[model samples]
Target: MCVNAGKDKESAQPPGCPVSRPVPAKPAQRPERVSLLSYLLRFRRDILSAQPARLYRAWMAEFRTPFFTSFLCNDPDLVNLVLTERPGDFPKSGRLFEALQPLLGHSIFITNGKEWERQRRIIDPAFESGRIREVFPAMWDAAVAAVGRLEPLADGRPIDIEPQTSHVALDVIFRALFSIPVEDRTASAVFDAFRAHQASRPMINTGSLLPLPRWVPRWRARKTKATARIIRGLIRQLVDERQADLDAGRAPDDLATRIMTTADPQDGSTFSPEEMADQVGIFLLAGHETSAAALAWALYLMALFPDWQARVAQEAEAVIDPGRIYFSTASKLKLARAVFRETMRLYPPVPMYLREAARAERFRARDVPRGAQIIVSPWHLHRHERIWRDPDGFDPTRWDTPEGRESSRRAYIPFSAGARVCPGSAFAMTEGQLILAMILRHYRVALAPGHTPVPVAQLTVRGRDGIRLTLTPRKTETP
Candidate 1:
């Protein structure tokens, strides 16, 4: 049975297509009228579903609050204006900062103003061009390890792939950052704690919508704090150990060493141990979780669209050398890169970026007030009805065309845009494309019969019930 059979049949392909393209999880239709309380309750389940259908076409939508107003912006120009042109006027929202404080503290992911700039100044060089290539081997090893882990799961039984991808992604971050695989006790503990923390918190900061004093004493659940502490403690241990290594002039030239030793040019200061822990927390959370989600969705999409999968596998066979996956060879996986890009478009890892107006400002002829929430929803813009042709459909080949390129320039922002854009965007693309190529080259993935991936935003976009698929070993000569 088609997973999206309930959707309009006209949008679906004619009969006898090799495989049915997977449609993203859509929100349940909203009642003609509903109270804000009811909507908020539903929103806790899935943000995408909580939205009204008209939002898919609307340029901007407003939600009123006793304390503050929030706007979801879908206009391409407006989005660019907020994210790129006037980012200083729209800082990261306080509600988001308060909600994430238990986990991220003052990590770069949440900070704004001069502090954000300082963190970025110190952290950016760690991911500079040369460093990405240096890290390629670690990413390659993790991809290969992931393939080995999945080999035993190719017996046709259903497999929940989210955990598997999470494991591999965690392994990648561990090895790349500290030169230690996730098998280490402390690393494993951090990974487990992170999972617990994510389970205990809402992916979206709905609390931001509530009008409460910034000092109202935000209440974090006990489990959330406990888990965050465990994760931070473990990260601190790693950072301290790396510090010792650096002091002894024995530190390996990995991401951790580089980040720790690279002082801020202006202040000539490094991340103190606690600060380092905070940065690592964001790195592990953002780096691994987002990539894991994207990879799982990419594989599921491949399973749903075998023709594209076959093309990817063929490209991998022709381009990727099994003996060694190098940085130079990564760009050769063009089809695989396209698949990753499209997957992000359909299910952006960080679905919506939340910011607040720093001062009263008018936008799109609407009155704005200080403290108003400004939501730039990549999820909505990527699939905006007025933007891309066949917005919801998966077409990897479209990326090569002029229209697709133009739309991407205007509307696509999976990693976001402007100066505050994710610094690790290039690293992530390499990791994602390489992993996808490696997996498709070795295994033929198919959606488990009677299973459909229900997308939900956890720390990042994930399958609510977990993505279930079957892996079959591919019998092909490695390039």
Candidate 2:
């Protein structure tokens, strides 16, 4: 689910289940001032821990690795320049394209310039704010399904929640996009293959560090490639079928239909099956994987901090009538939205955004050269010592304060910003809010005994051993 986590777990473990993503190295394993070779070695293990802790406080930090001269920019101004003000100057990095090429091909997520813009032009219509309300029923169904699935597991015992969240999130994406439940044969195949793919795709390959040309052959793991093919192949079949339905004028009015039917604004050209598949592939990943991460983390946050949980549950109870769900209800979930927002602040789904500096630029009086790897780390920025007060604390109410509003305006980008910002930003937020509120409304979550979740960023911010929480059905009306 993590689109890019640098390398992956080095194991030949069976790939049918949810992959236990990499955990952070113990402090003893991560010493200060390591050699470039050691850094690369450690990156393959856990990319975040490989860096010095000072990155949490530094405005701008530079790393001179052989692969590229890199700068991790925490300064708000620099982040704006790269992502918002002058995005063309800092397109997506080539390394990201290389990492995701196996699954995404040349989808908008990894492409840049005219091609990326064109894809956005065609794809954005389906995800516009007004269009999201149309998909609310699918999200609600997914949430209701989640409640049913958790009913059996709502005993006093502890269970890992990551898998459940992943399952429900994938279900939401499937229903919303293709109007098919995740249990549908083809949809199930894609989901199972993805669980298998996560184990194989420690994204970085032998060619990761090398300055190889696009034409050069890159090494990808045999299993990684195989799983990627299976996933994409299944998606291709899905889009092809959808295209046929569209031709016959019987396509379900879903996200896939809207995307495939909407011609590119500039060219007035529709996407071919292959192109639609490519976009859909990224959609499944971005939509499903990231949503799962947000939900899982929000649940864990509720478990660890019950006061906030109570507040959100009360809000959910007040806003949502378990009897029937309405799209308007999503707009009324204020506390749930705040909690989800806070969860992302503490653990950004895509931990970092990598952009290559197209031209040499100076930042905070430091020289930056063309070809430098520009890193905008939400993981660090959200908790930057110089930025937010009590930076590491989980306080959903922070979003309501005057200071919080100012800081959010300056910082707070769970989804990256500007022209290349996630087209589904609004959709993701509404989904996150509604689903989270719905879950807490039916069940109370608490931290599993002796199983504290340690935050680690991979594909998305995940617990070191998966988040284990104890679930109990709320005695009130069940939704």
Candidate 3:
């Protein structure tokens, strides 16, 4: 289904400027073509390689697709051109967006065009740095609560950090987004329904990759419907409560209120209750899931590299003043931040991004026919051989300097990028650093005997079997 890059008759030629001269014939050029068989061979080659970065580079040297295709590129400039420079011409893929639609509905993350813009306007204000500052207390509270829960586990005992991080992040998201703890039975049910729905849906990497119909998967359809019911009921209750508060001329200055009050500048329209629920659903999923992935990965990395963990602990100890209890101190731990950045580089929460060409266009000198689905993987880019010096290595020190940050940005995209970038990136990073620093301050983690974290692609890049580690009391205990 490739479309040619030519104008239609209505826009063909203005009266007669170039009618006299025939267009010059150009020699046909092969655009790095790789047949389906060769493509899968390259895919397997890269997947099996010890150095995946080099393999990705080799894969990029050719094009491959049998049915519906995806162009996997590792070039930095080319990527920037696609994601940042001309994003309008390359919208998020319809297939991918539709797959997420069951869970996210028409939320900002899944929708494009004017609808996406409107949703973004309503929700973006709540994720501002100032808002994140307001929510720091909530995040610290969750981290402290998590640490308290883990204190009972003795040294040498295996601990699954994924559930712990998940719980902490879910608490943070609930408090930050709604100013209410997720302890209510109604709220718990909503989140439970969502998790069930996620599990029921088959593993579809991106929308375009799957050919299965929604009805063919009866369980998925049921879960989708159940998810909508749970979320809608929760949203209706919350909205009514907030509206009642507003009626009484008093409302908490929480995320809910902020979104309720935010109006589009151009049209000055507010989100309806249903629309607000959709936005809430998105933030709830995005906020918790992303932070959980980052925090868990950060801990896994720390466990694997004890020297760096110790260094981070020292940095955290030095920065945090006794009885201050401010999460803002997390920002001062430069090395800790570097470690978090490195972890994100290794296992970006949003590992892949998909876009569909708006119209036939040329990328670099290669022709990209319209309607082709383009796939870009942060998992591949962060480790792209040409982009990083030693791509596979866990080197936090690589992010210690200005040059390092620049280079990392060229390859690192845990939050994706451009207009569609994650709106809560600052909040996520701050929360991750604080949680990570707090964990380091409280415990010394080691790889549980016979255990190694194996990351796999899922709703996020998660440890397939769960990240198990041993917790030992830190040597430098505060008096």
Candidate 4:
């Protein structure tokens, strides 16, 4: 999975016994109980460390605040009910809307009911299996570009991989969506603006939990609004040009054109430039940011477990051709896919999901009021003590085990589940596998000595200081 998740605690180890297992790093858990003020302060700092360790074993944990109640559901059945069976009974939370609203606006990420459905109807087609195959060439080029950029940094010097993966992931999205690389000026500007925006946010914003008038300003509103405007403005410019291309019948067959031209079946209407810009903003965040975080952690995990890294590298050396790109190559990356899956198991990019109860309902035999926050934390669920075997151990091969497969079916939700699942799930998986394979094929990553990344989640799970590693060029026969 991820960091060394206290597996030794399960059985008594003779004092001073080496933990033999090479587990990735896990954040230290907070005490079981704390004052509301103390909890608030901790949450403001980092959502992961603000939690109790018992959450790993807990089926459902309730958080009662002065303003609202939050239920963090660790039970897989409960999670399925909330997300899969009865999603309509739990719409997106107000707190979630308040936190991401500035950047997302009415994007499918935050919309509800008919609006969400209509948006999905238009956006979903662009990411279909066939469309993903169409975009694979762009993805391949992005991976090649990323590996080339890292050539200078692959001198065995320590490097923070967060920004490295961020750049590449953003590059991948831009290339796929707009048929332009990240080096393009407008694409670069949007990337920079988005980077600034996410760095300032937590996964959730509890600061605005208090009952305040809409007129009252929340903290960091000015900064968030400013960056959102900058990014959205750049996106609008791109949309205008693409719309012109569409009007002139010279548009590239990319994701942008696909979505902007797809008419709603019910009403023959395509997204206007304004509407397309909003969707682009969502893709920038959900597709680019989350993929970056996961890829960084995946590399960090590779550094921690050299044996697994070597296996992936071996697979890459065998399956990948350094010459012309081929879409068929993605399916052969089984070990790399496993590595990515295990990495997300330990460090899900989007750690916590927040939804609001539509009506009063009983949960775990407890009375849950309507409007209460329903928290489905992939971070906790994936590593639940009762679900996965050696939950915290970094064994990429575990996916082949009975326990792993069963646990995965019951617990895994890195891209979430049901109706609101990430629309680009397939695209992200292919992107991760290709980039990871290409990078490992060219370079070897080792955890930089004296640097231990502490996992934290505000928006997406990432290292506190950053995931640092040393990359050395692989002296292999391949490219």
Top model by TM-score, which number?
4
In candidate 1, stretches whose alpha carbon ends up further than 4 angstroms from where it belongs are: 1-24, 476-479
Whose lDDT is greatest here? 4
Model 2 ranges with Cα > 4 A deviation: 1-29, 203-206
Q: For residues 1-479, could you state the per-residue lDDT of candidate 2 as single tens digits?
A: 32323124424445553433332122223676888788887776556667787887899999886667889999999899889999999999988888888899889999999888889999988988899889989999999898899999999799999889988989999999999998899998998998778766553453666788888888888988899999999999998899889889999999999999899878899888988889989888898889998899899888766768899999988889877868899889998999999888887888889899999999888899998889999988988888897787777889889989888988899999999889999989999999899889889998787776766656666676888989998877866
User: What shift in Å separates residue 114 of candidate 1 from its native position after superposition?
Assistant: 0.7
lDDT of 2: 0.84
Pairs with backbone N, CA or C atoms under 3 Å apart (clashes), candidate 3? 95-207
lDDT of 1 by residue, 240-325 (tens): 99999999999998999988988999989989988998999899988999999999999999988877899999998888877865
Q: Scored by CA lDDT, what does every candidate get?
A: 0.86, 0.84, 0.71, 0.88
List, residue by residue over 129-175, the lDDT tens digit for candidate 4: 88888999989999888989999999999999998999999999999
TM-score per model over all chains: 0.94, 0.92, 0.82, 0.95
Query: Which of candidates 1 and 3 is the stronger one according to lDDT?
Result: 1
Candidate 3 structure quality by residue, lDDT tens digits, 1-479: 23332322323455543322111111122224545565444432222121232434642532334446556666777678778888888888877765676566677877888888888877788888777778888887777777777778846699888878877787788777667665666666666765665454433433234444655542335665676577667766877788678668798887888888889987999988777777777787778777888888888888766668899989877886645676568669788788888888877877778788889866657777787777677877887766676666778888766767777778677888788889899988888888888888888887777766666555666675788988877765542
User: Candidate 1, clashing residue pairs?
Assistant: 27-49
Q: lDDT of candidate 3 vs native?
A: 0.71
Total clashing pairs for each candidate:
1, 2, 1, 6
